[model samples]
Target: MTRRTVRIAMNGVTGRMGYRQHLVRSLLAIREEGGLELEDGTILWPEPVLVGRRAPALRAIAERHGLEHWTTDLDAALADPSVEIYFDAQVTAARAAALRRAVAAGKHLYCEKPTAASLQAALEIARLAQDAGVRTGVVQDKIFLPGLRKLKRLVDGGFFGRILSVRGEFGYWVFEGDWQSAQRPSWNYRAEDGGGITMDMFPHWEYVLHELFGRITTVQALTATHLPQRWDEYGKPYAATADDAVYGVFQLDGGVVAQINSSWAVRVHRDELVEFQVDGEHGSAVAGLRDCRVQHRATTPKPVWNPDLPSTEPFRQQWQEVPGNGEFDNAFKAQWELFLRHVVLDEPWRWDLLAGARGVQLAELGLRSSAEGRRLDVPELTL
Candidate 1:
């Protein structure tokens, strides 16, 4: 079978997510699998043209991946008529300018979110793409996870009757780079560098909540900088200006309440780095990255409030495990395939730059809510 290639000028491929998830896992994995088969049976292959600021990094990545195209020049890459898509995985501060250039070049836009540092920039980029008549997509990777997919299945299957509330816990102890090197980059700890728990995580919560349950109508948030001082990559002590933790409550459209706590300072006691528990009249489900367990009302344990006695029931074992029912691909890779199909085949794609702007709006509102120490309404955005 013949393969139809799509050249993607993938910016920021040297970064952790850009390299590992997008390039190595998604595009390369798709290539390894003989690419995506279209309706006409031609395999659609993604050829990544690695773009970044550093020539050595770009060249090294291209050489490592056995990729032929790479450049340190964004303008030159955009000028290439054959490059049909531009994928941005750069830092939040650098994303807007790169996206604007890409949109102007008439390339299809697929990128990581929050698309820009602020809602205005995000909306502008979305509008630019729309005006250019380019197909666009944003990475809403969490919804593609096996656990969330199962959760969505249950929701669509009506397993949860009259859904009531949701609780989400997401965090891990990120090393402060004092004794051990920080797992994440140092820029993530500085507000001036576009770093904050609210900005980093609220967007994720926005899409996840809106998609799985209902659109979030309002949000109340409390943010904290748990660690005031942290050592950077160079072992130099820097004041951590960004909020390391955020506790937020979201009111969805159907009066379903959702509370999510996101923190970089917390130690994990759960099975996964992130988890969500959804409760409804009929049943309740706890879903992690790869596992989802549910307890129907009939099987739910009745525990009377007793401060005098230790729990006798095995609470964790009571819920039934939700099976995959099928093989699951890497979450990032799965979304990549969908975006590829959208671009190459003009298939219906829902998660676009507009959706990305909504995520950004949520983050911005979350910050404002925290600062004002009050609840805030989320207004709808129009292009």
Candidate 2:
């Protein structure tokens, strides 16, 4: 097997998603597993340099993992000729500028989304990356999820003949941190810090719908700040000006209607933290993070409505669970491996900043739709 190494400048990786998901679960996991083997028997060992604002934390992470590289100086990391790819997982406000800087430095660019606060800035980053002739990618991790993968497989297999509608339920109660501490970081509730349900989740829904069903044509949304005040980590209450919940409906290119409800205020009743149900002419399926249950049209049960009497049939039991068809990797890790391949082997990578900009556009238009109380058409994004 031909083996080589790619030096990656990993920035803003100290935060929760950055540290836990990207660094530990994905990058480090690959390293621990002896690197990734590509189709042509080429082994790509990804050597990541942890870059963040805190020097002590970077030192700790490197020492803990037996990694030799760690640095707080982003400028120095960018200046290094050995750093071939730049990855960012910073807060929403810091992502765009860092990505632009990376592109200007002539490095292959990768980052977490929204990519930018506005569509204009996101588009600019995409253009910059293209002009610089660097490979580019953005996180679209959910599409690789096992449950979603199964759904895609079933759809591709023609199990879902003539798709109709998709309903996505995503959210959980993030405590207000009165007596118990809040689960998410405090900045997630502040608009000025770039936090909101619409901004945080619509990107996921946009890509999911676009990749699975079709491109979203129009969007209508309603957003809310259910809890106006929330306690921070320091046990201090702060005004939560950003939206904590959103109910949105999207019209896809086909007649498929997708409605996704995202909230930090709701309680979970589904199989997972996030669940999506798709209804089609031939069958119906409900897919969670890792499991999917399906019911063919012929197997669907007829329920008689009688308020006074208990239902005879077990409603939930009517559907059968789809078996896990194959072994699955961590969804984030799966995407990371693909991005690495794209960077090293010149693989086709479509999830770039332009796609990320579309995500921002959806979030922006969702806010506009909520304010104007009308459905807004999603303009086609040109690369």
Candidate 3:
């Protein structure tokens, strides 16, 4: 079999999500597996060109991974004729401009979501990619999660007969950095840095809801900065200008109402860091990060509400665990392989720049709805 190398210029590998998920767990793992084999007896090998701001950090990462190419200059990386793709995992404020540059360089695009800080910018990026005729995609990792994949399976199999509603609970307390080091970057709480739970999570919710149930038709959101003041990475005090929590109610197509609460201030009380419970006329399912449980109409428990008396029924035990019929790889790696196939073999991929723009649009509308204290109709976005 012929083996070919596809050079990818990856930006922002120094960041948390960039370093851990995209670089180490995904790309490195792919390399360790001896590359992806295409249907035509050709192996598509990935050659990562790490790009970032810091020279020392980039050098360290390159040396640690035994990678050959590392650069601090994006223009130089983009100018390389051998590079076929440009991937961004940069901060929100820096993503749009970097993506624009990549598009201008005629490289295929793939990046983490909330394509831009605003809907307009995201649409503009999408338009540029369309006009450039380059293959493009945005990361929709949550949809690739094992639990969500099983949930999608159930939805496709009509297990949720006439799906009624979806309830999602996500997030856990991120420590204020004064005494305890914050789990997330300080930029995540700074509005000037394009940070906020709404901008960060609404995009995810948009794609997840749209892919699993239907497109969101309307949204009503209530957002808050529960922790007004927090310390930064350096232990310096800073005002938390971004919303730490968001309570959103979205009306989806096909008459499904989804209520999701995203918060960094709330302590975990559930089985996983994130969970989605979908209730239907015939059955109901609760899906966490890696596990899914379902309750059919026949097996669902019926317990009359008795506030005064102690409840006897074990409600949580009523649901049956969904079995994993197949081995699942890392979600990010799975999508990377798909995107690579799309770039090389012209394979069909639905999560394009347009899908990314839709996610940004949802975030913008959600923030607006929260500010206005009223439900807002979601308009269709176009490039």
Tell me the TM-score of each prediction against the true structure: 0.99, 0.98, 0.99
lDDT of 2: 0.92
Off by over 4 Å in 3: none
Question: Between 1 and 3, whose lDDT is larger?
Answer: 3
| Root-mean-square deviation (CA) per prediction | 0.8, 1.0, 0.7
Off by over 4 Å in 2: none
Choose 2 or 3, whichever is better by lDDT: 3
Q: Report the alpha-carbon TM-score of model 2 versus the true structure.
A: 0.98
Q: Write the per-residue lDDT of candidate 1 for residues 128-165, one digit (tens) a residue.
A: 88989999999999999999999999999999999999
**Model 2 Cα shift for residue 141 (angstroms):** 0.7
Reference-based lDDT, residue 89, model 1: 93
Residue 346 of model 1 has an lDDT of: 83
Residues 67-158 of candidate 2 have per-residue lDDT tens digits of 89988888889999999999999999998888888888999988898999999999999998888899988899998999999999888999
Worst 10-residue stretch by lDDT in candidate 3? 297-306
Sort by lDDT, top down from the best:
3, 1, 2
* Span of 10 residues, lowest total lDDT, candidate 1: 56-65
lDDT of 3 by residue, 223-318 (tens): 999999999989999999999999999999989999999999999999999999999999999999899999999987778988999999988888
lDDT of 3 at 36: 90
lDDT of each: 0.93, 0.92, 0.95
